[model samples]
Each structure stands twice: as structure tokens, then as C-alpha cells.
Target: MKNSGEELHFRMDLGDSIEAREQSMISFYKRQRVDWTAPLTCTLEGDAAIGDGVKRHCLSSVMSKLQFGFEWKIGAGKTLLFEGEKDHLVPAASQVFVDSDLFVVAGRMIGHSFLHNGPCLTGLSQAVIHVLGGGMPEMASIDIEDCCDTDVREAVELLKGSAELTADQKRSIQSLASGWDLPGVTEENRRWLTEKILFHAVLSRSKGQVKQLRKGLKETQVLDLVTKRPDTLPLLFPRSCAVLYSPQLLLERIIWPAESDSGDETDDTSLEEKCRISGFLREYIENASSQCLQELLKFWHGWEVPPKELYVEVVHGLMPRSSTCMETLRLPSHYISYDAFREALNAAISSVPTGFGLV
Candidate 1:
């Protein structure tokens, strides 16, 4: 019985020793694994607190439970085996760290590109053609396919009416209109084209003295011109007319005169003179009469032995020659805080002469 007890005790001692050796092997392997899998030297802090104590403890506990030669996963279905080489383990750890950051970077780039409003290839091409029409012979001209029928018709009418366009320019425009095949034309496109043609016509006419009529003409006079001779106003005014005349008011009341005051005889005489001038100008424009002769008549009618302020205003407004000049000008927004910029722009505007004369 004693021998039996001794044998049992020996077996138990052997089992305990085997466990101790297994634990020793595991500890040695864990030390080697940590060293091998350490991040790049630049990423390492010499201080131990920079590494989480709880995480290290958990990793060691997991490693101790893992059997030698068994494989385990650390991330996204990637496998790490307990054959335990530092080289293999370090690469896996680096890849896991880099993967998350790479995803974040890629996501941010896509969002930025989506939000960017820089001109696209289509818009760039359109802008080039608009700036340099028919100048680039080698490049295939983009057809004005989106222009509306109304717009095309208006352009044709404007070209026909414009004394500014040379015979050659008129012919070229007509030929372009006849040859061009525009599809899916819209109201907006038509309006856009009409304005564009009118703008070009005004630019062409700007070299002559007739461009002066735009300066200081009251809103009432402008509407009368538009109502009487629609063709001439559109041809002469272009963008400037739009600025001077209100389309909404014109549409609502074709003729709107200013209210008269009964207190002053001078005011009454001035009003009568304006009324006469307005009527005569309307008649002359409607009849397609000569502009030079019409201006001379306007001067004679408004002229006085002693020129009154009203007479001067009338002469300046109706004269064929005026000091007004169109330029690349813009008004600052009301919300802007830059007072200097606003003041500079206003000064430039004021420099333009408001006086007028017959050509």
C-alpha cells in the first residue's frame, strides 16, 4: 500500500514539472513575439505607460491559452499562427494600423471631389467657344443646338434692325442662323440668345456717336422709345436699356408719366416741353425718320434765350452726342463691408460726364 501511494505521488510530480516547462516555453515565446511585432522605431515611445497596461495583460493571457502551432486571428479574417516569428507578426500589425487610416483618407478625398465646383470639361468648352467664336477653325464648332426658336427669331430681327452691324457681319449672322440646326430650344435659351445678339450689336455700334443717347434719359423717355420703335430701342440700348428701364413697369403700363405739381409756373412749362418732345420723338421713331434731323428738331424745340435747368436737362438727355461711356462696371453688394472699394467704384461712375449734344 505504501509503494502504491509513492507511485501515485511520483506521477503527480512529473505532471506538475511538465506544466512548469510548458509555461516557461510559452513565456519565452511571448517575449520573442512582442519584440518581433514591435512597430517601426519612429512610432515607439521608450516609456511603458504609452502602451496600455490592460491591453498587454489581455494579449498575454490570450497567448498563454493558445496552443503552440495553433493559428489565431487578430483582425478582419487575417490569420496569425503561433509558429511565432517576429517578422511575420510585425507586418500584420502594421497592416492593421495602416488599413483604417487608408480608408479614412480615401473617403475624405471622394467627398472633397464631389463638393468641388471648378468648371468641368463641358463647361470649359462652352466658355471657350463663347469667348472666341469661329476663331478656332481647327476645332469643331459647338452647334447652338439648345437655342429656342423664339430666341433665334429675335436674333434675326435684331440683326436686321441693327444699323450698327456691317453688311458683312449681317450676312455672316444670317448664314449661321440658316445653317445651324438647334434642337430642344427653351424659352430661357431664346431670351439668352436675343440678349447676346443685342449685346454684340450695341458693342458694334459703340464706336459711333449714337451710343450717347443712353445717358441721362429719364425712365419715361426710354419706355416711349421702346413702345414706339421697338426695333431701334433693342438695337441701341442692349444691356444699358435694361438698367435704365424697368421691364415690369413697361409691361404693366406702356406709358407712365411723372406726376405734375401745381405750385410752380416753371415746372408747368418744363412739363409741357417734355410732353411735346416725348410726342415728337415717338412719332419720329415710329416713322423711321432720320436720327440726325430728329435731334436737331429736339434741340430747337427745347432751346431758350436764357437756358433753364429743365432745358439743359432735356438737351443733355436727348442729344445724339453725350459724354457717357460704357465700361466693365459692377455695383458692390449691400452686404459688403469694404467701404474703400465701394467709394472707388462710385468715384469712377461720377467721373463719366452726364452732359449731352447733337451729333
Candidate 2:
């Protein structure tokens, strides 16, 4: 039943108060579903134009989804009703969903950028990861780039000198050299390896080249005669040789020996034999030598031949033929694993003095 005269009536228990009745009425009104505003459609004016142009095509495509709608109340009790076109709401909701999905995808892409190890993306990738992981992106990028550049340069140099390098080395060298020319390398690092360093290394290797130049002079007395001639001495030396010598070509040869001789048998045999003999002698001396040389000398009294031959034999026994055979006899392996190995390595390193080990 409805009450008039600016008051409302309702059936209630005796305990019901005005406040309770008002609250109940308010709750009822809220549940009655009064008309409320719906989302308005974004309008697109003029005829829809489609063209081969990508931008116009996209605009026309998006505008096709634009449609308007409203909300209203109906019946004596005032029930909610949805009115006008509702098609646009689907597109609007879809757009929101697509945007959210895109955001997520973008976030993932940024994350992946950091984890990647490629030359181009690694820096940006790490930066994105750091930011996403709650670190400062800018600072991380700087640090990462610095470390990457250093590593890249070192790797490039190593690969440039490596025996096993392929076409990758050439490509890496080109790439890194280009990077070195970039502003990021800085002027200070630019001076690290200069033309002077190259020149000095060339000069040092000049002696080896002079030896090669004097190879034919072994039978001829030209080298000795030149050494004796005061005026010719300086001229006959590196200063004269430099005119004919190509330091670049020489250095390239020394740096990459593989390019010169793939089947150089003398290089393999002589170097390997000498190394083995030197190693064996060192091991023998280390095992045999006592703190008191005079006491050790007493044992050598009965020895007929020179002790050098015995040393040579011992070297041969320790490092026979190949490194694998040497290993079978318990000679040091290339791959060391422990402190004891390191100590043994130290012993090996110190046992032979320079020139003494030469075959």
C-alpha cells in the first residue's frame, strides 16, 4: 500500500523505527533499477573512405565499429532497460582487451631483450630486464655496454689470432673494429694500441727477420764482414733491411703461421721433439738434484760420458713421442685441475732456465 501527504507507509513489526523504515525504503529504491547513463559512442563524421594507403585503411577499419547506445527505465515499477545500438560496446570491450594484451606482449618483449646475448640486442635487452626486475635501466645499460664492449674486443683479438677460427673471425673483426671507431670507445682507449706499439713489435721481430735474411749468409762471410765493417755495420743491419722488409706482411705471417704452411713437417717434428726433450731434462734434474751439489757430485765420479746425454735420455723417457704417451708415463697434462697440479706446474715452470732447455 502507498501512503500520501509527503510520507510513506509500510507494514512493519512494533519494534520498527523511522530510521529502519527509511533504510528499507532506500534499499528498495536502489534495487528498483533507476535509469542511468551508458557509455557514449565516439563519433566519426563524413563518408568512410578506403584506399590502398595503410593509414587511411586502418582509420576506416576502426571507424566501422563506432555505434551509439543508451540506458532507460521501463514499467510502473521502473526496471532497467538497455536501448539504442549495443554493437559498439562489443568493439569497445574488445579494444580494451586487445590493448591490455598488447601491453603484456610489449612487457614480455622488453624482458626478452635483456636476456638475449646477441651483439645488437644484448645491451637493450639487459636494460629492459633490469628495469622490469626493479633496477635502474639507464645505469644497467651503461654498465652492460661497457662490459660487453670489453669482452667483445678481447674476443675479437683472440679470434683474430686463433688457429681454429673460421669466416666468423673476419666478420667479428670487421664488426668490433667498427665498434672501436664508434664514440663509445672513447679517446683514452683509442691510445691503448697505437701505431707505435705496432712499430715497436715490428722492430723487436726485426732480429728474427735479420736471422732469416742472414740464412744465405751462413756459407758466405758477408754477415761477419758486415759486422766487422764500421760504416757498413749500421746500414747492413735493420736500417738497411727495413727498406726491403714489409713489417705488416711479416707480422701477419708471425701472427697467423697456419696461413703460410699447412703441411710444414719440419715445424711439427723439430718443435715437438725439442719441447719433449726439454721437459724430460727438467723432470730428471728436479728429481735427481740435491741441496748439496758437492755431495751429488760424488755420485757422478764414476760416470764415463757427459751427464748431458743422461739428461737428454731422461727427458726422452718422460715425454716420449706424443703428449698422450707422455701422459701415460705420468707427465703433466694440458688440463690441470687442482692445487697439487698447480704446484707441479710451478715446479715444471721453474725447473728449466731460458736457453738451457733449447735443443
Stretches > 4 Å off in candidate 2: 1-186, 189-192, 200-208, 228-230, 233-359
Those runs of model 1 whose alpha carbons end farther than 4 Å from true positions after fitting are 1-137, 142-265, 270-274, 289-359
Q: Which candidate is the best by TM-score?
A: 1
Error of 1 at 2 (Å): 99
lDDT string, candidate 2, 1-359, tens digits: 11223321112121334344333322322222221111111111221211211121111121111111111112343221111121100011123323333222222222111112100111122222232233432243322122223445354344334255456654554455454453222224433333222222222222232233233232223334444553543332212123232223222222112212346444443444444534443444445423222111111211111122111111212222111111111233332233443354344333211111111
Write one digit per residue (lDDT tens) for candidate 1, span 140-160. 232232222344444556544
Error of 1 at 93 (Å): 69
